[model samples]
Target: MLLLELVETTQTVASTRSRLAKVDALAHLLRRLDPAEIPTAVGLLSAKPRQGRVGVGWSTVAAAKEEPAAKPSLTVADLDAGLDRLLATAGTGSGAERAATLRKLMAAATAPEQSFVTGVLLGELRTGALEGVLTDAVARASGRPAGAVRRAAMLSGDLGGTAMLALTGTEAELDAVGLVVGRPVLPMLAATAASPSAAVEATGEASVEHKLDGARIQVHRAGDDVSIFTRNLADVTHRLPEVVQVVRSLPVRDVILDGETLALDEEGVPRPFQETMSRFGADAVRETVLHPWFFDVLHIDGQDLLDEPLSVRIEVLERIAPAHRIPGEVTADPAVAERVSQDALAAGHEGVVVKAVESTYAAGRRGSNWVKVKPVHTYDLVVLACEWGSGRRTGMLSNLHLGALDPTGEFGEPGGYVMVGKTFKGLTDELLRWQTERFQELEVRRTAGTVWTEPVTVVEIAIDGVQQSPRYPGGIALRFARVKRYREDKAPADADTIQTLRALLRP
Candidate 1:
C-alpha cells in the first residue's frame, strides 16, 4: 500500500474523537493492506515499529531536512526496508549513513507522509487510537473475535504481530497463542481512585495492598533461566540479577511473576523512584541493589493463571514467595481499607491499591477491577510558557512550563520564579482552546514551539511528589505532574515557594 494512504487514515483518526469513527477509518485502511505489508503498516501506525527505535533522535530528524515529494510514490515496503537499514546501523554511531538514509526516505515521502513518518520515529504520534482501539479495528477488519485478538496481543506483547496473524492466519492459530514461559507479557494496569475507601467501594471485597513507589517488573522463569522485563516489556534481565536470583529461588520450575522492585534503605524503606530508575537505566549492576516484592503471580509450574481470580493467584503467590510478598490485607470494610492506607504511608510506601478478589487478571487493561489510590501534592505554580501541541492537539497552547516562587533568592533573584517542570496532561478540549487564545494574549515573547507568557498566570498543579534532578535550578522536578485546575483566584505571588517543593526531596 502507498504510504500516503496510511497517512490519510492517521489524519482521519486524529481529526475525530469518536472511537467508532477512528476504528472505521483504521479498519478500512487495514483491509486494503496486502498480506506482506500488514505488519509493517500496523507497526508504523501504532508508532511501535517491529524494528523498535532505530537510534534516530529529534535532532537527527530535525537536521536532515528535505522537501516533500510532489506526488505519492513511496510504498509501505519501501519505508520498512529503510527502517531495516537503520536497524542494521543502530549503535554504530554512523550519523552520516543514518542521516543519508533518513533524508532519502523523507525526500521520497509527500508532506503528510513525511509528517506521519517523523511522528512515528519520534514516538510522538497522537492518532488517538490506543492499542485497544487498534486491536478492536483489527478484529473488525478480520472478522475475528475481539477478545481473541486482545488476548493474543496482550500475551505476545506485539500488537503488530498479533494484527498480522489475526488478519491473515486462521482463527485456530490465533486462538492457539497461549502464555509462553519465556516470553514477556503485557503487565496488567490499574485505574486511579481518590481514596482507598473509594477504591474498595469500586472493587468490592478487595485486596488492599501497599502501593510501593518503585518500578514495575514482570519475571518469566523456565527451568533455571529467568528474565525480567520493565512495564514497557523491555528486557532488563542482565541488569537485574538480584530479581532473577529471587525468582530462581522459587520452588516452581516454570513461573511468571508480576511485581515491583526498588532499592531499599537499611531500614527497609523504599528508596526514591528516580533512584530505582537510575539502576534500571544502567548497563550493568551498580552498588545500589534492587529487591523484588511479588504481589501477584501469573503462571506457576506451567499452570497459566492469567484467567484465574485475584484471590486464587494471591493464594498461589503467598505459597510460592511469601517472604517477598507485598504487605496487604483482604478486607471489605472501609475502615480496614483506611487502615491499610495509613499503614502504607507510615511504612514509607506510596499508598494502597484496592483490587477485587474475584476479578480475573485482565492484562493490558485498566479496568475498574483494580483501583490505585495515592495522595497527591498540589501547589499553585506560575505558568512561565506554553508549548505548541501536536497531531490532534495541534494549533493549541499545551504543555505548560511551570515555575515556583523563589522568595529567598536561594536559587535566583528574590521574588522570582524558578523552573520546576512541564506537563501537558489532564487537559480538556475546552481548556486547550482557552489556553491557546488566552496565553497568546499574555505572550511576552515567542519561539518556534513555545510562547513565553508574563509570569502572572497561577495554575494549580498536582504531583505524585518531587524528585531530585539537576535539570532544574531548584535541584528537583515534579513527578507525575498534572493540572488540577487553573487557579484564576490565585496570583503569582501566592504561588508555592521553591523551598516548599525542595522540602519534598527530603525523606
Candidate 2:
C-alpha cells in the first residue's frame, strides 16, 4: 500500500463526522493491505506508531519543510522504514543530524503525505477516527466480531499486534489472548453520573469506592518483581519505586492490581493532582513520597478475575490487600451510597465511583457499569493556543486557549475543534516555565502574543458550568474555568466534545 493511500484515507476520515463512513473507508483500505503492512498501516491510521517514539520535533519538521515530491511513490513499508530510521537516530546526534534525517524522509513524500507524517510524529493528528472507530474498522475488514477484536486487543494490550492477528490469524487464537502477569491490560474507565445516589441507582447493589484525585495505576506482580503502568500503559516502575515495593509486598504471587497512587502530605492527606503527576516525569524532584491504594484485583494466584464478577474480584482484593484498599462500602441503598460520597468529600477525596456488584471488568471502555460522581464539573479540553504571559508571568506561555471537539461538525468542520474559552488560573510557577519551553516544540503558528499549536495536549479544566455565549463558535463558554491537571494519558480525540458541554445547559 502506498503512503499516499493512507494519507487520503486519513483526510477522508477527518473530512466527515459520520462514524459509519469513517469505518467503511478505513475497512476498505484495511482489506487491501498486505499482511506485512497491517501493523504499520494501523499505526499510521491511529497516529500511534508501533515504534513508540518518532523523536522528530516541530523545529526539525519546520527545517525539513520544502517543495513536496510531484508524484506518489513511497510505499507503507518505505514510510515505516523511514520512521524506524528516525527512531534509531534519536538521542545519538545533534539537532542538525536529526533535522537532516527528517528532511531526507520528508523530501520523498507528497504534500499531504508530509503533513500526515508530521502530524503522526508530533502526536497532533486531527483525524477523528480514534481507537473505537479503528477497532470497528478492523473488525469490519477482518470479518470478525468487534467485541472479539476489542477483547483481544485489551487482553493482549497491543492494538497493533491485535490488528495483525485479526487480519492474518484465526478467531480461536484471538480468543485465547488472556491476562499475563507482565502485560498490562488497559484500565477500565467509568462513566460520569450527576451524583452518587444517581450512580448507585444506575448500578444496583454497588461497591461505592472513594474516587481519589490521583493517578491511575495497574500493577503487575510476578513473585517479587513488580511493574507499574499508568492509565496510558506507559511503564513507570523505575519512577515509582515506592509503589513497586507496596505491590511487591502483597502476599499472593502473580497478581494484577488496579488502583490509584498519589503523593501524600505529612498529614497523610493526598497532595494536589499535579504534584503526584510530576513524579512521573523524568526530571521530577524525588523528595515527595507516593502511596498506592488498591481498589480492584484483576488477577491473583494464576486465576484471571477480569471475567469474574466485581463481587468476586472484591473478595480477592480484600483478602490480598485490605490495608491498602481504598475506603468505600458495598451497599444497595442510594442513601448509603450518598453517605459514602459525602464521607469521601469530607476526607478530601474527589467523590465516589459506584460499581455494579455483578459487573465484570470491561477494559478500555467507558460504560455505565461503573459510574463516577464528582461535585465539580470537569472536562478534558485541548490546548489550541497559548498566549504570552503578562505581569509576573511575562515571557511565559501562561494563558491557555482551550477548545472542545466538534465531532459531528454541528458547530464547525467535521472532526474539527471549536474554541470554547481561555484561562490562566491554576498555573504554578513551575508549570508556567514548563509550558513556555514545551509548547514551543509543538508550535504550528503564532501571533505577536500567542503561539498556536497542534491540538494534541489535553488539560483537565474544572468549570462551574457552561453559559450562553456568542463569542465562541460553540455558542457556550466555560464558567469559572481553571486547569486541574495536564492529562498526558488522554488523546485529543478523547477530550470532551462541545456538544457535551452545551448539553449542560439542559434543565
Q: Estimate each model's TM-score.
A: 0.77, 0.94
What does candidate 2's lDDT look like per residue over 247-357, in tens digits? 878788799999998888888888887778777664444988888998899989889888899999998888999999999899999999989999999888999999999
Question: Which regions in candidate 2 have their CA more than 4 angstroms from the true location?
Answer: 91-93, 282-285, 406-416, 489-494
Best-performing candidate as measured by lDDT: 2
**Clash pairs detected, candidate 1:** none
lDDT of each: 0.85, 0.86
lDDT of 1 by residue, 1-507 (tens): 999988889777766666788789999999999999998888877656778767676668878779999999999999999889987885556788899999999999999888887766755455556566789999999999999999999999888889899999999999999899888887777766778888887788999999997778889999999988887778889999888888888989999999998889999988865578778779777999999998999988868998899999999999999999999999999999999999999999989989999999988776799888778776779999999999999899999999998754568644568999999998989889989998886665689999987677888888988999999999999999998677553446568889878877768
